[model samples]
Structures are given as structure tokens and as C-alpha cells.
Target: MQRAITAIYRTRDVAHLVRDELERLGLARHHITVIHKDVRTADPNAADTSGTVDPADGIVPAVGTAGGAYVGAGMVPGAYMGAMPGYGLGMPAYSEADLVYADAFDALHDLHLPEEDTRTYQQAIRNGDYVVSVEVDEDADIARIQEVMRRPEDVHDLTELDKTYRDAVYAPRRRPPREGYRDGMMGRRADLQNSPTTRDYIREEPLWPKGGTA
Candidate 1:
């Protein structure tokens, strides 16, 4: 598995490039994951022409007529502000404006957060914008292989998720995202809590041992 945190390639055609690279590296197609990068902007004219973005120097400012306006983000300004120590003998520590437009640009371009799940800046992130885009588990071929024992992962010892990672890293609850909505403090949504599916599945899993002869 290629576990290194390497972009290896940056392009609008990231999905295609990733598939090609995995084949070149002689890895099974099922093992590759392409971290996509998508840009959101209201102005079409100002979007970069070449589709080339330099991570270090790219300007993520919402520079429009007067002040930049970001779509899908309700962050006009003054939403988030923090202090910054001024660089002078007696000067006071200046503060960072709650500039949502500026922050989005920096997060996507500067931090190379083209597509990640959690945002380092939230209110900046509207409650419903596609920030990070991860492809749904496109490992169907791998799953099929495993079912036939060509690959074996289903019957291993109980391997629970990491406590810290699951409890905290996963936003709503210890459950997976597709599990459904969760309530305050991250409990399962009431409708699904003690669901019949859960109750039935636990008692009816395909876990019986086969009869054997010596």
C-alpha cells in the first residue's frame, strides 16, 4: 500500500491521473485513492485560466468589486478573529480579522487542503458546502475478491476502531458517517437508536461454524 502522504500529482484531471499512476506502479486498481481538489468561486472570469495553482504563492483572497464575495459560505466578515503579536519593539500584537473569504483561499491553496473532511476554519465553512470530497469506498472489486477468499479480511479477530480516532476524529459519533444522523454529544439519532435492523442483525449474523469431519 502506498501509505506516504504524497500528492505525487496535482491536476484538474486528478481522478484519471491517479488511476493511471496506480496501474504504472503495478498496484491493484482497487488499492488506489485519489484525493480530489475542487475550487468554489462565484466569479467565473476571475478563476485562474491555466488551472495551475502554486501552493506556496497562490492568492486565496476574495478580491471582487469592493471586497471578495465567496459563495456557499456565509462568512462576510467579523465571524472569526484572533490576536497576532506585532513584530516591533513596542507595537501591540495585531489580530487576524475574521475574514472568511481570505481564510478559504488560504485553507484550500496554502494548506493544500484541496479536499479534506474537517475544516480548520468552520464558520468559514458553511453548514452545507462540499469542501472535501472523498469518493465513496470504491473497493467493490476488492470486496468481491475478499468474499471468495482471494483476499481475506472479513473473519479476522475483532479489530475495533482506534478509540481516540473513532471517538474524536469521526465527527458525529463512534458510528460511521452513513449510519445516519446523530444527536447532541454525538449519540445516534432517535429514529435509528435501537433500530430493528441493528437488533435483528446482531441476532442473525452469518457466524455459525461449519460441521467438520476428522
Candidate 2:
């Protein structure tokens, strides 16, 4: 069965690094996706539309409108216009940011994740955090991808976040600290290094695939 494993990162750079590492692990680039806020925009709520993956190469294209206008495809009309009044008179009705947010939300919803979890991730992206999702078939691949994502120094596991939210909302209970929490917030590299399949795959595949440089 195919399933998605998603996590949150503090920055776009770290999210990209995680994606690259996943690709190095023999996961297809198209199976991975990253959504984050557009730092170039002064508005914190604006999302980066360029983060959408191109179906041709599974890469985020460097495309954007010149004056903060949305001009590409997959736009959701009136997605945000209804929320803000007076947008029907002279405005473009929807900004590029609005379209991207709608796209991001739609992408996350397609994963079939829980409604609250999806909303939580959307809010995180709106708050400028990066969300990286990987689609996997085999259980081993799921484990491998999760290991790679969590190996990042400051990545947050979505499952853990969900658990924390549930615990806070339902019952406050004492929970043990996460593994490697005391080790300067660094993930355990030894775990991945110890995996025989991971070692062999890393040896077989070039870190950078042909046709592009990471």
C-alpha cells in the first residue's frame, strides 16, 4: 500500500536538504514534496507558489508573477476573495499567495491525512515552516524515509506533534523525552549508517543524479 510520511522543518534549506537525502536513498524525486511560506513576500501569510513540483521533473520550478499577481495554472478563483470584503470591486480577486495556499491545502488533503493534522500542517506552513512529505510503498521504505527526515537536526515528526496535541487537549500526562533529545538536539546518524540496505544503496547511487545539481 502507498502512504505518505510527512514532517515539518524550521526552514526551507533544511527541508531541501532532507529531500535531497531522501532522493539519495533511492526514493523517486517525484514522490517527495515540500511546501513552505514565501520569504520574499513581506506578508507572513503569503505562501511560495514556486514550491509546487513540476510534473515533468518533480522539481520546484523558479516561476512567479512579476508584481505579486497570480498568473499561472491551477488557480482557485474566489478562494480568498470571499473572506475579505471589497475584493470584488477593483482587486485581482485573488493573489498569487492565495492560489498557492489553496494548492498546498489541496495537496495535503490528497494525502488522506486526518483533518486536524492537515489543518495543523497548513497553519505551520502559513507560519513560515516547511512541510516535507514523501510517498512510499514498502514498509522498509517508509522506515527509511522517516529516518532520513528525522535525521535532520531540527525536524519535527508529524506523528509526535499529533500525539503532543492530543495529550494536551485530552489528558496531560508525563511523557518521556524523545530519543537524542539530550544530545544537543541532533538526530542519531548511527541508525542510518547501521542499516545494511542504506549503506549498500548509498554506495550504488550517486548523491547527485544526472541532469541537475542539487
Candidate 3:
């Protein structure tokens, strides 16, 4: 089985150049995946092309605008200040405004990356970074692939996302319902809250069935 290695870049143009370089270095184009945000349909003139942006910088103003608008709308009734159009700090990681526009490209190839790797790349792309993943079976090839794609300053290191990615990918698996557990309030109450990893809510008093006899 081939192992997947990924990298993130700042610009779509650079990502394309790296993809071409990877193809020339014996890595099959089909084995590479470039994951990025799609923004082709956006008005060409509407984009903010004023060089690089810090996600934190945009978040504050967007939040202030939303908060003020919400308050104004509540007071003035028909007057509505719509939500801020772009992403800024404090918003969820992958919200519409938080997305960074990527170069127009079709995902013709699939790297078949592991779930963990895919999650890692997904976060990077959502953070407005361009991501590239290449599969290689040989250990030596890993270094070569990275070397060709290396822009140390530009690469979004997967190591930094280890904690966040693992929590997102594995947390759901840890929370699967216990055997024979149902789905509604009945199940929630009956289910033994045993897992130490999650919150525990058990007591001698009956808190269900609308005031049941304890």
C-alpha cells in the first residue's frame, strides 16, 4: 500500500507548478491530489486580491459587523444589515466567509489518502492554504516528493493539526451507541454513561417519564 504525503502552499499558481514538478519526477499525476477551495463562479472583480491575509485580521471586523447589524435589526424592525460577506477570525473553520479562493482546477486524480490525512488536508484548505497529496510506496520517495514540493515556509505542516484532526476523526467512533441503545430521550436516559472519556450523568433520582416515582 502506498503512503500519502501532503503539503500546503499559499498560492494556486505555486501549487500548479508543484503539481507539474511532481508529475515530472516519476510520480503519476493520477496519484496526486490537490485539494483547494473552489471559487470560479465568484465575480472576478469582487475578490479581495490585496495579497496575503491573516484569518484573524478579517474575523474581528466581520464579527463586529454581524453583532452590530443584529442589534440594529432587532431595534429597527424592517431595517436589516445583512451578515458580513467575508470570513474573519472567530467564525467556524470552514464557513463560507472563512474560505480562501483557490485557483480553478479539476480534481481529475485521486490519491486515496487515509481518513486522517484527508482531514488534515481539509483543515489546511479551509484555512485558505493550497494542499497537495502524493502517494508513494518507497520510503525514499517520501523525501523526494517533499523535496520537490518543499517550500518550508509555505507548507502547512500536518503535525500542527495532530490533536484537532484526531479529535474530529476519532471522537465520533468513540461515541457510537452502546449495544441495543435506542435514539431518543428514552435511549439517552437508559444508556449507561460509562465511558470515562465522555461526560457522565447518573443519579439515583428518576428524571424521565415526566415525574416518575423514584
Q: Report the number of the highest-lDDT candidate.
A: 2
- The global C-alpha lDDT for each of the candidates, from Candidate 1 onward, is 0.24, 0.46, 0.38
Least accurate 10 contiguous residues by lDDT in model 3: 59-68
**Could you give candidate 2's per-residue lDDT for residues 32-123 as a string of tens digits?**
66766442211123444554344343333211211122223454454332323444344334344545454444444333344466656766
- In lDDT terms, how accurate is model 1? 0.24
**Most TM-score-accurate candidate:** 2
Pitting candidate 2 against candidate 3, the one with the higher TM-score is: 2
Question: Could you list the CA RMSD of all candidates, in the order they appear?
Answer: 17.8, 14.5, 18.6
Clashes of each: 3, 0, 4
TM-scores of the candidates in the order shown? 0.21, 0.50, 0.41
Candidate 3 residue-wise lDDT at 81: 20
Q: Tens-digit lDDT track for model 3 on 55-122? A: 22111111111111111101222222222333233332222332222211112012223345455555
